[model samples]
Target: MRIGEVLHMNGGNGDSSYANNSLLQQNVILMTKPITEEAITSLYSSLSNPKSISIADLGCSSGPNTLLAVSNLVKAVDNHRKKLRRRHSPEFQIYLNDLPTNDFNTIFQSLPKHRREIAGDGSGLCFFNGVPGSFYGRLFPTDSLHFVHSSYSLHWLSQVPKGIEENKGNICMAAYYDQFEQDFSTFLKCRSKELVKGGRMVLTMQGRPSQNPTCHLWELLALALNEIVAEGFAEEEKLNSFNVPLYTPSLAEAKLVVEKEGSFSIECLEASQIYWTGYNGSDDYEVNSGYGVARSVRAVAEPMLVSHFGEGIIDELFHKYTEMIVDSISTRPETTQFTNVIVSVIKM
Candidate 1:
């Protein structure tokens, strides 16, 4: 997987708009709510047999968000253990997973603060350094983990959105989709191998309905950045350089992939139209709610805008697109959207 994709907009240390305090709260709330519903509840139930419980977060980026996941998992397991009143506390194993280049330092730094609570159960949280080498291969010892949770991640293909940068046309899209299917299938197959009997996994990723494809979101993003390229705010090379790493995988595509993987029964699969706190649901606004979504494109947009329209034209160009989105939003607030998919599967 490309390091940039793993690092996407949420690398933490404050540069990321979504990592800010207000947004992090919402993300935590959204992420934690579902863990109680499916395989996670079952995972907690297994805490009665202490040795049977193990929880992990897949694609956990460095930030308070990942730590929050760890803490919540531990608390959930503890709750289950208490109800059962078992003598042996479930041994906690936390797999701090992500691309190798992930900011482990930040993740680690945020951990010690929880040492007291994490150590309260006597059997402290075990931190594993496994970085699922590739999405297509097994990362854990067989039957090692009881629960796996991934949030706001995993729509990312194992590599850059292949051929989109080169504008490879139909051939590019077809090749990329083929690779997505193959890689996702391999990922599920490999995950199936490591989960213990009756274990479960939950994945929250961005998605689009097969019926209502939203390819225009990408077009909007591209247009949003065109101003940065036109102005000196961002680089032209960067504009043409990177892609979203994913184009909303359809629910049908997701279901087809899950169906082929064995011993994994789909529990709950849903697609919800969700709002991004940072974006004002307007296209023309460069920065919304001080979240600075436009700043994200600055890395690439700055140089491109300068090259295409000279140094000073960027602001105006960005303004033009921003206004377009704002006007668009006023016209279609309900339809102005982003989609997320939630799927939980249980092992046989």
Candidate 2:
């Protein structure tokens, strides 16, 4: 299936929604806040007494986490204005872009409250618009954006990578780095055209350790699905046909793509590890970690799973997945963590 046509986080504020289960992504947002602020600060410093700034958040899946990075960027700009003792903070025209299938209604629904809150703070005049489409191509007019931010996204290929005949039980796009590299280059090139000179893009993407391209969490999910198939819950043929259109590129690969793309200059690209549950020590790891992992995975992966395995298997499948996760955590806690690469780039 084409990922753009089907891939979306569970919508709304319901129990199974991405808004409910995005702790892992939320943690990534928190971790990358400093990088984002630094990028924004640099971008603003380059302008003399700027009065307005255009920002875009790409692949902004619908959830509480969706507004997070953008919120910080705005806050940073506001704080910077205070430090400068400027009479007026810059006007912000913020665009939240995602796939056409994304839950834009939910995003729009939350905006009124968000607007009220921001206005109460007296931060600045801000206008929000949801631009629904893939980011692999241009989504804005030339020189329309000043800064771009995306977190816990961009590892997703525009489609499943070609040149791999069989990943065979493994659903992730790890087996085809060449196609992934090309698509990433294309994505960067497209963004370059939309950004003004000296504009910046700060992105955080799911990634893997260069020593190991395979993230164990995804591998564990593949294991759980295979178990389901073994028990006749899912047909082998269906299993063979199913694949997630996502790839976790290594830091080296990501930098290489940027260099090869040749439109943007990489400022910083660093990888850090995060636990699957995003455990904060307030919760019981052994008791809640499995379910937390399951919820996060379910929120993101359910659309693809339902499309291929039918809606009936989702609950049961995630239940089995939770059990498998618990077992993996018990035996090898290290296996439950994955790396995220945060990249900050400047348009040349």
Candidate 3:
């Protein structure tokens, strides 16, 4: 996807919920819904019992997802407070953070009026604070946050890996993997300082350690683009400009990096593989529901598709791509697969 398109996809906000909100109800909710609750309950016991608490949701794109995630955190904190036997709930400074280019307009407009409705009375004190630039850099005051949460967001790197743009051999392609490691470590270091001692964090991101992070996902993306290229669709140059920043980390790699970030104990690790079965098994979601996800993968395919296929067969290829998904799901596996890792850690 072009930078402009990516900006449009990431920043814009609307009702992108899948049919019946199945994405939330069937899969994403099962994996990420409770980490916030588990982390908050465990974290509250370790804290010094402060009256005002701070928390943030990193990479919180503009949409209902952000609100739902925030709601998850709020519910967790509220449940924990009850155990504290405190009638006066602490002030919660919750920051909904994401890239500056993100559509704050949509996010701000869509924010819920009653954050506490599901969890009951609590002064959420919600705030819209853009990370402004990048997650690899500082976005808040020192030791300012009590808890940090990010979901299906951190797996994306700051930008596409270098040299992959040039289409060099695997040598250059490896840049994506190297970059993911560097960025993740940098993120930890940056986040470490912002968190108070014992601050807690929950993150859910897509990954596949068994496959080469540098190649597999991009290869799949490339294959998808190839079809578009063969049939002629978008411009090839635009595709070349896009890149995904994240690399799926192996279990060992994830543990090593967090351990290096000073003192952090990995609390929970789970595998969540998912299939993007759009409403009624159709691909029209590219224009609506899948917009954000589609934009995220654009860099992986656009340039190759356009450059290879030119402009004649774009639509034809997309049709083939869509059908393939349905066909694959209907076959034997029953559903397509995506491997995800959910990690919870505490800074000591």
Q: What lDDT does the true structure give each of the candidates?
A: 0.60, 0.85, 0.60
Question: What stretches of model 1 exceed 4 Å from their correct place?
Answer: 1-12, 21-32, 46-48, 117-132, 161-165, 168-176, 215-217, 227-242, 278-328
Residue lDDT tens for model 1, 240-309: 5555455467777778788876668988887766553345556544346223433433322344334433
lDDT of 3 by residue, 116-167 (tens): 3643556445554545456778988899998888876666666666556645
Q: List the residue pairs that clash in candidate 2.
A: none
The lowest-lDDT stretch of 10 consecutive residues in candidate 2 is 278-287
Identify the runs in model 3 with alpha carbons over 4 angstroms from their true place: 1-26, 116-128, 168-175, 209-211, 214-220, 234-243, 278-317, 332-335
Deviation in Å, model 2, residue 124 alpha carbon: 1.6
Please tell me which predicted candidate would have the highest lDDT against the true structure: 2
In model 1, which range of ten residues has the least summed lDDT? 166-175
Ranking by lDDT: 2, 3, 1
Model 2 Cα shift for residue 140 (angstroms): 0.5
Identify the candidate with maximal TM-score.
2
Model 3 — which ten-residue stretch has the worst lDDT?
13-22
